[model samples]
Target chain A: MRPLDWVVLSGTLAFIVLYGLYKGRGSNTISKYLLAGKTMPWYAMALSIMATQASAITFISTTGQGYVDGMRFVQFYFGLPIAMIVISSTSVRLFHRANVYTAYEYLEKRFDAKTRTLASIVFLMQRGLSVGVSLYAPAIVLSVILGWPDRLTTLGMGVLITIYTVTGGIKAVTWTDVQQMLIIFAGLFVAFFMIIHLLPPGISFTDAVYLAGAIGKLKAVDAKFDLANRYNLWSGLIGGTFLALSYFGCDQSQVQRYLTGKSIAQSKLSLLFTAMAKIPMQFFILFVGAMVFVFFIFVRPPLLFQPIAMRDLESSQVQPRYAPISAQFDRAFDERREAALGLVDARRAHDGGRRAQWLGQYRQAQARINQARAEGAGVVQQIHGEKEFNDTNYIFLSFVTRYLPAGVVGLVIAVIFAAAMSSSSGEVNSLATVTVIDIYRRHIRQDAPDRHYLWASRVSTAFWAAYAVFFAQYAKNLGSLVEAVNVVGSLFYGTLLGVFVLAFAFRRVTGTAAFIGMLAGESAILATALFTRITFLWFNVIGCAVVIVTGLLISWLRPVRQPVAA
Target chain B: MINSTFMPTHRAEMPDEPPPILGSWSRIYVLVLVYLALLIALSYGFTRYFS
Candidate 1:
């Protein structure tokens, strides 16, 4: 990156951290430290929620997903609004009324300590690993832009976020999240407009959309009912809803965000805002990716978008084998560009015959391009010995650093850092809260003063931050960072959501039954994940179903014991 | 027996105020669901139109 890019990136990051620290002042008490004294407004909580969910991987891999796969991925969020409404109505009110610091705290009030502990451990296990992946995602951006090693960048980001989060607690995290989200929005709008601006002058927006649609990249939804298919309407609605329910309702990171709202109404409003905005926001991001695809169609993109992988391929023994494919890919791109332009002219002139002819040529050229890419992927796999060698996560970043002008490039990079920090801080902070409130204070030192618990919170935050940095060193091996993060969540979220569902709806399920059902549900989820090819989205539904069913059956088998009044 | 010491002060009071804009929490939730439906329909239209 140029000096201006460095200036913008550094300046934006510094301002966010300082602003977070400034807003986070006076977090001395445990409640203020952990819950921001329940004073957060709807807007702050809403942005924090959005920022936490939209990690750097969302920007990096999603746009690349748009380019390579199409916009069907937006359907993955179809259940978010529904999940938001459900959670706002049920979990938000329950947690707020109960005056709990963490979601698991309420599980104990309804069920038993064992159930709450089990759920909390599951959260730590899933979110703990995912936070590392979140930290590792933006390191790819820094690695590509400044040629910094991934390890150093990950460590740097982890430390910076840890410092602020440890000092200011959730207050710093939430307030900075609001700022980071604004930067992300600015970056997204700038990048989208820039892509349009960079497109050849003759290619109007509608013409570009036509080309993208002709090549099957503008498909924002698929109404097909296929369980095996990952991103269709059915999976998105059912699986996505279950996932979002688990994420927004049960996950401490999100629950904690809304829990900081000034009142129950504020919390509900914050979540409802997210419910209304999330779908359109995701659609816009994916559309930006689609536009990036259109942009690359006019300007030749690299055969493999990952620069490091491309360099490694050039030096590997497979270079000779890849050479012909690279040449073919170039030839196909040239032909496709010509056909795309010709199709636009034909459509303008109202010549149906010529339009059809160029459309066929464009499609054939696209097929040839795909074949070349497939060959290149094979070469990459052969060289790396990794079968799932996908460079989708690197595609948009490659475009940004190589194509965009200097200051904007920095702003985009800042957007990435902002995302990484916002997400990682929330995760680490929530992890710390769960550890201290659920485990440390509850199990270890119940009678400790608020000052003691506050100290433990900071220490726990630091420990989790260090652990995330250590785990992030290994996140490089995980393919498609976005999918990797979600798959990891799916593996655990289903069981967590099931436990919450049982707690909320199944009043007769005893604590023992719920606890055992959680174990059974987790086992079933694991079995499905190992033995089946079911899409990850269904894991949430399957896990929740198994837990509820298993809990109910176990409860029915046992004689109902009258509740011993506490 | 399950421990009670870990539990916070349980004051499961009703929310003090109604929803600010929609006048009721249930109405706000319905509006969100309706918004989701409209979004999906529009997305489907976008898909079909583009295709």
Candidate 2:
């Protein structure tokens, strides 16, 4: 990046941290630290909710995902609005009325102390690892672009977020997140328009869409209800709804966002705002990725987009053997581009026969290009033996560095950093909230003054921040950082959502029955995950069913003469 | 089974009518139903536009 771009990047980030500290410096009470004194209005709450969910991965890998896999990935969020509605109707009011600091705290009051601990443990395990991946998502890109070691980048990003988050707590996180999200949207809008403006002359936007569609990049709708299909209408609706409920309703990172609202009505409205905006925002991001995919059709993209992968090959002992394969791939790419351009020109001329001929030829050329790219990937993998070799995450970054103008490049890079900070800050804040509220205050040092716990919140924030950074350094082996996080979430979201459902809807189930049901449900989900090849989204549905059935059955078998209030 | 002339009495006067509990969750069903409708509509609209 140029010096001017670095100035913008540094200036934007610095302003956020300094602003958060300035606004939230005098937080002396635990309520101020954890719930931001319940002073936030609807707008701040809505944006914070979005920012926490829209990680650096959303900005970086999502575009890349669109570029590689097309817009089909947008189907994953098809269940979000419904999930929001469910949570706002049920859990939102419940949490607001209970006046709890963490979501798990409600579990204890509604169930038992042990159940709360179990839920908290599940949250910590999932969020901790996810926070690590969230940190790594942007670190990998920045490190590759700036030529910095991954460790330095990870530590730098971690420390920067921890500064404001530890000082201001939830207030800092929500306020900074609001600012960060604004910048993120601004940066993405600029990049989106610039992409359209940069498209080659004589190729209309409609033509570009047609070409992308022809290549199967626009397969966003699939009617089939195949269990293995990850993102179809069926899985997205049913499985996706459960996933959303678990994520937004139960996850402290999200629960903490709306929990800051002053009134139940305000919190419900805030979530409703998210419900309305979430899909459009995601659509925009995925569309950016799709446009990036179209952009690559005309440009001569690299055989291997990942800098690390390319570096390994360039410096390896097998460089000589790999040189010919790389050349072959480049030749195929050029041929494909020529063919695509010919098809575009034919369409412009309004000649049906010519257009059909050129389109057919372009299809064949595209096939050859895919074959060549695959062959090159295999060679690269063979050379870097025993290592994961997917480059989908790096593709969009490569495009920005290689193709985008200098100042825009830096702005987009800053956008990525903003996304990383937005997500990681939320993670650290929630982790600290749960740690201080559920574990520290509940179990240890229960009678300590609020000041002691207030200090403990800051301490825990720093600890989790450091832990996330450490985890980021070692997560390179995990293939597809996006999928890895979701897979982990899938493993636990269902069971957690089930437990919550049992708490609210099934009044007959005893606490013991619900607790045992959750354990059994998680075990069943994990077993299915291992033994079957069903998509991760379905896991949510299965797990929820397990909890409801088992809890109800156990209740029926051991009918309490008089039911416990909890 | 009651005749048309058998009118229901007010809760304060009638012995059969139960008193309203302070936090009886009488509104929860309506709230959940409304929310469920919104979720379905929103999700459907998203898929239609983006897909």
- For each candidate, give its TM-score against the true structure: 0.96, 0.90
Alpha carbon lDDT of residue A159, candidate 1? 79
Give per-residue CA lDDT, model 2, range B17-36, as digits (tens).
11133232334334544654
Clashing pairs in 1: none
**Tens-digit lDDT string for candidate 1 (A92-142):** 877887789999998898888889899999999999879998888778667
Off by over 4 Å in 1: A315-319, A477-485, A563-566, B1-11, B14-16
- How does each model score on lDDT? 0.87, 0.79
Where does candidate 1 chain B have its weakest 10-residue lDDT segment?
B1-10
Cα lDDT of candidate 2 equals 0.79
Q: In angstroms, give how far residue A305 of model 2 lies from its true place.
A: 0.7
Alpha carbon lDDT at A115, candidate 1 = 90
Flag clash pairs in model 2: none
List TM-score (chain A only) for every prediction.
0.97, 0.95
Q: Write the per-residue lDDT of candidate 2 for residues A1-566, one digit (tens) a residue.
A: 77877888888878988988987777779999999888888889999999999888767878887788876676677777778778876787777767789889987767778878999999999999899988887787778866868788788889888899999888988899899889989988988888787787867787777677666666665657888888877787688788889999889999999989877766876787787777668767877888877787777777778776677666768688668777776776777677778767776787778767766777777777677667767777786564555777787778777777867887888888888898999999999899989999999989998899999998999999989998898888766665777788889988888888877776666678878999999999999899998878888899989988998898889866653346
